[model samples]
Target chain A: MAKNQSEVSGIFTAGSKSKPSAAKPKNPFTHPLLLGSIFPLLLVVVWEVLSRLEVFPAYQLPAPSVILGTIAGMAEDGTLWGHVFITSYRVLMGFLLGTAAAVVLGSLVGFYKHAEALFDPLIQAFRSIPSLAWVPLFILWMGIGEPSKIAMIAVGVFFPVYLNIVSGIGGVDRKLIEVGKMYGLNMFQLVRRIILPASLPSFLVGLRSGLGLGWMFVVAAELMGASQGLGYLLVVGQNTLAPETIIASIVLFAVIGKLSDWILKKLETRTLHWQDRAAKS
Target chain B: MSLQLERVGRTFAGKPAVQDVSFRAEPGEIIGLLGTSGCGKSTLLRAISGLDNAYDGVIEINGKKVNGIQKTTGFMFQEPRLLPWLNVLDNVTFGLEGNREEKQKKAGRYLESVGLAGNEILYPKQLSGGMAQRVAIARALATSPEILLLDEPFSALDAFTKMQLQDLLLEVWRSYRSTMVLVTHDVDEAAYLCDRIIVLRGQPGTVEREIAITESRPRERGSSELAAYKAEILASLDLTTETA
Candidate 1:
């Protein structure tokens, strides 16, 4: 028995030694941030070279420097900040409204069987219609103002959050619910303590996707509207044959989209820290 | 607290899972519901815990009929079932009703008793399997329940870890003296820890036999006296041809 015990302890020590060696230190040059920039930088270099050679007419494919110059010009007049602020405010209001409605409705449907029976089919059918298809109808009813634009963005954000919230609540582990019951938690306590926390990771996934779609819908709404937003800027640029303005607007959209996504990603890391550790180990 | 079950029965879609089961447990007694797989021992444990309300007949805890989950019982499942988002201290204090300071103190005491004194801040995912289960044990004990219903709690553990936990369980039971009903398929485990073993068998499962341990702990492990009890249980389970 002593010999057997010693052999078992030896095996355990050997196992621990092997695990550390398996996780070799990553190379510094191959870091993710550095690797991610390579392709975009290469593309910019190629675009600069092509524009210098006058490959395409400057009116159609303006050089990167010309787009930068347009940005600088807009900044001087303070129009760039105005357009950015208005567009951001619209997106923010729409996203918040959509998220609030989705969470409330989703919780009702997810928790109660009768609510699911009443609302599921209608919502699922309505969600199938493309969000952009609502733009014309919204403009017709609410007019070519901020309301229509915000409504369009809200519609864009709603479906993904609703679908994800419903599925997340539905997919909570039954065993965890049983554990709650075993501990003598009341219905309210069960929802607050167990179901909500369990569904959060999935809900965050939906929020990230909804944020992405919000940007897309904002651009589409602006494409058909009056004035004073990035989408209107794009249309005005096209009418005046100013490709630099169009490129500048597109770049701004990209930067804002990347920034909002980065914020959400940080929140996910903080809230789902447990999931990250579980995955690693 | 004492527990009494009178003609308890559970069914699923008109098929009986457990039928006409009746037993009585005196206060602070450690009883093992021993059986093979598919013998409805776990189903019986669930009924006793009041997690399943669609059952026939009466389950009484301390002379009160249990209709829903009772406040006097704590249940430990096969898996540790710790809420993954909570740290060890928070998980141990879960479902406990008290002022924040009182709850934290109680949780701290239980964690210390489970030999997890310095690991209160670790999340569930960061702990090894045995350590996680120990934290779960602390959580169950923190409630100071009159009865602890454990359904195959150690079955998922490795042999060495299982033995260590068994010792820990015995120690905890000695200190708390809570009524315990453990469901397990392992004969040696039942023989070693239980004051009495209730053997369950067949479909629409019913009690087959009952044996009293009679020996006192700390009983010697692998001794001939304990071996005799194990042999009797094995024969009852039909794993051997030897006559008891």
Candidate 2:
């Protein structure tokens, strides 16, 4: 609520306080907190009213205050940030590792026939298996350490990026490549100048899909035995019957995922401004 | 150096595409390889640019056998074929080899010269057909090759755009002093641009006749000199002189 009001205050505070701009009017539904969290707030209000009215036992469904208190308790102990930071770190690492491998392999496999012929089947076979399924094998191989979690996320994130890169490379226009050749560009120049740019729309698609998979896999990777992570908090909360804690962790992941998507979109906007403008029509 | 082809031939799937065709383009001269459809004019252009290696010919560009060599010449296609991913400046300087700042400066200057001033950031999709062709020309000229081969570069353009670009070509040609060979089906277009026109009358595109246009730059459309040259090319094409 404060963040929402602050944003409004900032906008209204921009120069010129004399005659109020006739074109501008206050939006009735501007606050994201009100827009998105309203349903949850209403649900909480109804739950509180219903429980107080003896709709169900008080212990069966705790009030919103109880959930807030639980969150305060988690924060006071310094466990909340630790859990969040660790999970974020794991996701970041896994995503980066997967992205690097995918780009190199994807570009090669996408553009080079011989390399693709040798590498594609193996990648395909491995990608067919689920990320969750790898937990047991990873644990056996790495003994439930950070390596196991990292491996789990990396495995989950790799295929989408790899597949997308290959698709990007394969989808490049042959005509443009010929144009490069006609202009006296050599092989390296052809790929760097023509093939890479031509495949960018596809490469970006790959990055986005792979990024989504990163979050999905991070949750699964955290499901295994671990001390620090939002996913771990949920696991711990579930065992103690603290639904509020579980909800908080779930909210954390949702917020991170949404924020990451927004950031990626910004980056994509800058990278493909022309492409996007062309896309609109 | 002059572009020479001695008994140049290419066969695809056991059919002659360009059969024993031979021609020469001298310095500071425009040569038009005019032909009816399916006469392998574009194929011959590709061969001369060292792009098509599946031909039995000796293509000497600047006295070097550059049939399959490093990019010694620039070839323009019917479509402008500017890289869509790049902006106008980048597309214009695409053939330039240099460091980052140098490439940007050269690219900027060429784009300005092409009258695309201050449109450096605009992509190929943002520009009109005429503007895109200008960038293609900039790219071709950026290479500073000894020979320039244009394959119906203005055929896709509207008549107005074609005429404007034809004059632009003459301006660029005069400045660059590059040996130029342009292929086209338009009798007027060939007459307006070429210093010397090489008409490929028979099939498979062996040179049939040559018509030299001694007309000055920015030649008027209804001038007697241009009309005479056009009449000569049409007669060589076995076309009646009644073409308005």
Candidate achieving the largest lDDT: 1
Q: How high is the CA lDDT of each candidate model?
A: 0.88, 0.78
All candidates: DockQ: 0.42, 0.21
True contacts kept of each: 0.44, 0.32
DockQ of predicted candidate 2: 0.21
What would the per-residue lDDT of candidate 1 be over residues B1-244, giving only the tens digit for each residue? 9999999989999999888888899999999999878878999999999899999989999888888898889999999999999988999999689898999999999998877776777777666677778888999989988999998988877788788889999999999999999999988889889999999887888988888999999988899999999988877877443234
How does each model score on TM-score?
A: 0.94, 0.84
Worst 10 residues of 1 chain B by lDDT: B235-244
- Tell me how much of the true interface, by contacts, candidate 2 captures: 0.32
How far does residue A61 in candidate 1 sit from its true spot (Å)? 1.1
Extract clashing residue pairs from model 1: none
Evaluate residue A181 in candidate 2 and report its C-alpha lDDT on the 0 to 100 scale: 83
Q: Which ten residues in a row have the lowest lDDT in candidate 1 chain A?
A: A10-19
Residue range A68-160, candidate 1, lDDT tens digits: 899999999999999998888888988998898899999999999999999999999999898899998999999999899889998889889
List CA RMSD, all candidates.
Answer: 3.8, 8.5
Deviating ranges (above 4 Å) for candidate 2 = A1-73, A279-281, B98-109, B201-208, B214-218, B235-244
Report the poorest 10 consecutive residues by lDDT, candidate 2 chain B.
Answer: B235-244
